[model samples]
Target chain A: MTKSRIYLSIALLPLLSVPWFFGPSSSAVVLGFPIWALYSLAITLLFSLLLCWILQRYWSLLAEDESDVE
Target chain B: MSSEALIDGGGLVVMSLYFLSLIGIGLAGRFASREESLSDFYLSGRSMGLTVLFLTLYATQYSGNTLIGFAGRAYREGFLFLMSVTFMMAVIGVYLLYAPKLRRLAERFEFITIGDYVQHRYSNSGLTIVVTILAIVALGNYVLTNLKAIGLIVEAATGGVVSFATGIIALCAIMVLYETLGGLRSVAWTDALQGILLLLGCFAIFAAIEFHYGGLRSLGDQLSAARPDLWLPPSSAQKWGWLSTLLLLGIGIAMYPHAIQRIYAARSTDTLRRSLQIMVFMPLVTTLFMVIIGIVGLSQFPDLDRAGSENITLLILTDLANNIPGIEILILLFICAALAAIMSTVDSALLAISSLFTQDIYRRLRPDSSQQQLTRFGKILSWAIMAAMAYLAIQADATIWRLIVIKLELLCQIAPAIILGVNVRRLNAAAVLSGLLAGTALTLFLMLAGDPIPSKPLGIHAGIWALLLNLAIVFLVDRLRRPAE
Candidate 1:
């Protein structure tokens, strides 16, 4: 894998677990969702956009043959 | 949620017409067939373009569970089930790990079944057979689950005018007839139609609920006041479960045999790449909509018991049909979409099961069999398997989500063999074979051992633990094998 692709994957993992980091507060709401719920949704959308960018930019790199990997 | 017929005279007529159109497409697909070879039967002559590929993948991946089961889960679990959208996207994310290399290799090898890939990569007969058997069992369970859904929908839609057993038998016959007539070409064509219907269905219901209940903001306010626990952050245990679910679904679903075939069937690498890029955004529309609808149901009908919650989507629809003027048409559309979702998944799995049995097991036993003979046997196999699964669906009483977990657990065991095999050239047949066996054994032990052992220890699924062990063993075996060589 390329250094950039590896870095992107690492960045993506933490975003997937965003729900785990918040507290039990429903005191705040966003567009009909609690702060944590809405936060998780926003992070998921960001995760998807980043994945799309990775797919478009680094697809050829990811698709390279095993011989090219470190 | 009473046991009343949701569809009567005109509704029955529309549903019948929909059923007949599928068979019509089957006949059309047969005429469109290029040749009688297994390659043509299973992979559609390796000529699928972007639209057909995308729709087929979409329809095949999202089953009736996405429509009904997901809504029910959301109703029961509250917002924690929003993880449904994340896990689905994870399936697509995992696809990127190996689909590109696998697609190129499949084209070079002219692969027909997933077994063909395993056999080629490992050159080990035992490993190939084991993997194929694992795939068939998992897929067989998939067919059974969907078959039960079809039967329940028909029985409920008709208010017992057509019994559950009758529903299973009739739909099974329709699926097998179309499948045997046109093969994957017919299945993909039907899937495209079904995919469109599914999208329309989800959107219609989501709009109705959002408009009827003010908006998400209103619903959120109500939910926050009524069920404060739902708005709270996940407990530590729930966090572990969320991460575990992502691993199981992400890795397991990408390894589905029919899903692998779609990669090989693509007309070009660009077609496959574009289809998957578009798929990354589907969860936003498909799963997120269902999650919202489920929450809507929870807010509307707060007193339903656990079993009643599973039918929350149906309850919401039935309530709408009774009250909303001009909404019956939309309900009919949703019904057809639900059937489309169930039938589309069953047909693809049936085709995959037939190809695996004929190519992997039968042909291995009889090397002299020609492609014509194998294709003929595959047609016969689809009919036989569908009959057996339909019968089991009638007799069985297991819940759909439990069946889903069992299937994914078995299917995920084969991931190391396929995913690791593609990426690591030095990963040998023995390493994969040992890892697969160890993982499967551990999963079964954990699953069957009750009371003394919790089903999901520390809120993580048994399958996830087994998978971690499986991956560790694969690398360990590879390391040991290197020095010996």
Candidate 2:
């Protein structure tokens, strides 16, 4: 993916990272957490994974130069 | 805050041994030093390997606030404090915006401090001086917050056998001693140890909770039954607040002088990249556990006010000791880790402050100073700053969150300068300076106008509003400058 596209996608991740869609009236619980709290943490875990992927696959291309180090 | 001592003789022995090991590491780093140059003392000669780099970053980023204050915040705010996890990740995510570009420049320029980049990029002495002073103030506040945390941990661990003032003075002396002796090398080495302890500490909290109070499920049920307000979904204003927090912390923390210097101190780009990749997962293990502990505290002790809530972790551990046999060992381990977390952060901040003072502020006045002279001056500055912050910590009573907001508000004003300056080559120094000052003025005005004007007007933090104004001014000034050029 293009750097701009990658960044744009990362920018959108925070929207999901917050549990905005869950309303106050919902009483659902997952395991031992409120459903919204569970959703927030699940999304955060995904956020971590996706960021790791981006770092591994794209950072070398985006960074200035690698010849100086290795 | 508790009068009775919780830890007995064995725990005290473990604590003493931990302090001795840190001093030992400092001596080792002193012997390990290659030269009297500022780079050798401050950046570890830019030779930090992947393990040390990753661990030090983890240790530095998760401070005493993460363990104590954050849990307290969670207890008070409930599920809304889960925003803490998102904000922590945002700090690393924002790094992606600047770290790669900044790392390349740092290697090329041999940058010793964040001010070096500001000076090199802007080529404006006035802007550099202003940026340096802002960074110093922000970092000084960071040290102050962590110093207070150190006193709390020491006093709590000893069960008030050691007074708060004594804890502050003694730990401050030890931190300055090792930092002066070994500098970044010593600090990083100690941080690696502290990082492991911190991770284990989190796991201990999880294990203890599961063993005694059942699982998070039981705690969640209890909280819902007892304090239904906590389990309720966030309000509209809170949703807006979360988004605002994401923006402010995501961008602002990346500007931390100590964290930025870590980018310069990396052995290679690959190492830095790998380390940061791992860092993204940290909130899961560290922050999530703290949030859980806070929730557990809320469910168990429903009547705690704000100040009492901050000591909820200690309360939980003390309760565990009373119920569970042999749990005191794990509790002792957690206390050591807690101390490690607080000290690692303070030492790093002190080192950054000393470097910023000696290189950015002092060097500007006396350009003829030798590297050895500057390095020595940095050591002395660390001592002086520690003493002052120690005094302030003992006397002051502000909450950690308040200090965090103030520091980040000041630091975020400089983001356009550092973040945009790294990416946009055509960005002018005048544009950045104007935006920085305007943003800072608005934030200070709103924050200082405490009683009548709300700090988070309309549910959004004052810092985020200031940042919006800051960015708009930067864009406008850049456009005007383009026409003139």
Candidate 3:
């Protein structure tokens, strides 16, 4: 996939936080003790998505200038 | 805090010998390897693989707290302390946010400082300085917390030969020497050695305790009968608090300069990715080890007083180990691990903070400074910072979590500036500054008001409140700066 696609794919992980905010299980020891897995994954995916978009939109810079090559 | 120390002749010798060896290892790092340029200085040319990376990460992450302060928390709060284990597991997942992309970019640019990345991405010197300052302060607090642990070990194990001030000076000097000489390379290599000792020490002490107490099941039965809440997860105080904490600490702790600096230091994207994958499973081993130990304490010491709970972990281990035939030696080993944790974590912070000052702040003002000259001065700055921390350690605070939590509250405000700089072009410097100021003000207000223990409103962490306000202000101001799309 393109750079934007990759970044978005990552950022989307963080967006999962919205669902996490909804609620956790009453089964806390296995599920609720700390929210690192659920919340962090969401934030990471969200960040990656944003970064993917930026990289793709700025893709022109990735093109190598053959004439300038040594 | 009376030591209630069980140290005797053999224990004293083992502890003293370990200090000697650590100092010797610190000096050995000064023998420069046959490599050239900054990468060699900072990262040993990215030669570390999964094993070295894993050990380094493990030793770095656990630090003095696991052995010294964490058990104290566990003894005091009972089941509520397990939040530490869960949060650590969460810290692993938190890495997924930037680890992948950060690894790629770091390899691309040979980036060392998180400040450097922010500076390059945003082309803003102001942003770089802000990040560098925040990082230096946060790392400084981390060192202070670990230093207190160092003081405790020295006093207890050395029969008062090493006063708190003496221990701080000696350990800080050794750590700075090794870190400045070999950079991240030496630190990683030493961490590999130290991490193994740490794990062994944990398991050995744990087994000794369990065997003495008639095993895990019997211990659990005792705790459950006496303190049922110790076995169950946190109820009123902890459950309400975990929500904001999951987000606040997960993000804030991951932003440590050393953690991000490693993304740049990794040999390849695969190395970084694999190391992080391993990180995902570490809490199972690292966190559970400490939690189980803490729970076992409940059975051994029936009527443990609150004021003494902070010292309970050490007290119980010493008391139980003294009676054991084979385990007294391992208590000495734990002392080594304790020092290793303090040195490895603080040394990394010193080096990172120094680099930020030399590369980001100092050079920005004096662009023409020679690389050799700057590197020389960086070494000096590292020592200076360590010396300051040594002073803090002597007048140590007993409340480990308070120092760490307060520092994190202020440091969390950096997220909008550092994390958002990469993709959000509309996130103007003015907007970033506004967000930071607002967030910092809110955090300080809460802290200053002395909002009772644990949390304030809706069971949320104070940092989360500040961060929420910070982000909202960033976006609101950013929108005004560049109108609606």
* Quality of candidate 3 docking, DockQ: 0.07
Tens digits of per-residue lDDT for model 2, B392-420: 99999887889988999999998999888
Per-model TM-score (chain A alone): 0.69, 0.82, 0.35
Interface root-mean-square deviation of model 3 in angstroms is 8.9
Model 3 agreement with the true structure over B350-425: per-residue lDDT tens digits:
7778878877888778888776677677777878888878887787665677788877877788877766765454
Ranking, DockQ, top scorer first? 2, 1, 3
Model 1 lDDT tens row, B1-485: 24678877899999999989999999988999998899999999999999999999999999999998999999888878888888788887778777878888898899999999999999999999999999999999999999989988888888889888998899899989999998999999999999999999999998988778765677775776567688778887888888888888877888899999999999998899889889889999999999988888988888888888878888888888778887888768888999999999999999999999999999989899888898999999998999899989999999899899989999999999887888878889998999999999988888889998987888789898899888899888888887664
Candidate 1's docking class is: medium
Instruction: Answer with 2 or 3, whichever has the higher lDDT.
Output: 2
TM-score attained by model 3: 0.83
DockQ of each: 0.52, 0.59, 0.07
Q: In model 2, what is the error at residue B205, expressed in angstroms?
A: 1.4
Pull out the clashing pairs in model 2.
A32-B217, B5-B159
On DockQ, the stronger of 1 and 2 is: 2
After superposing candidate 2 on the true structure, give the runs of residues whose Cα lies further than 4 Å from its correct spot: A65-70
Q: Find the 10 residues in a row with the least total lDDT in model 1 chain B.
A: B219-228
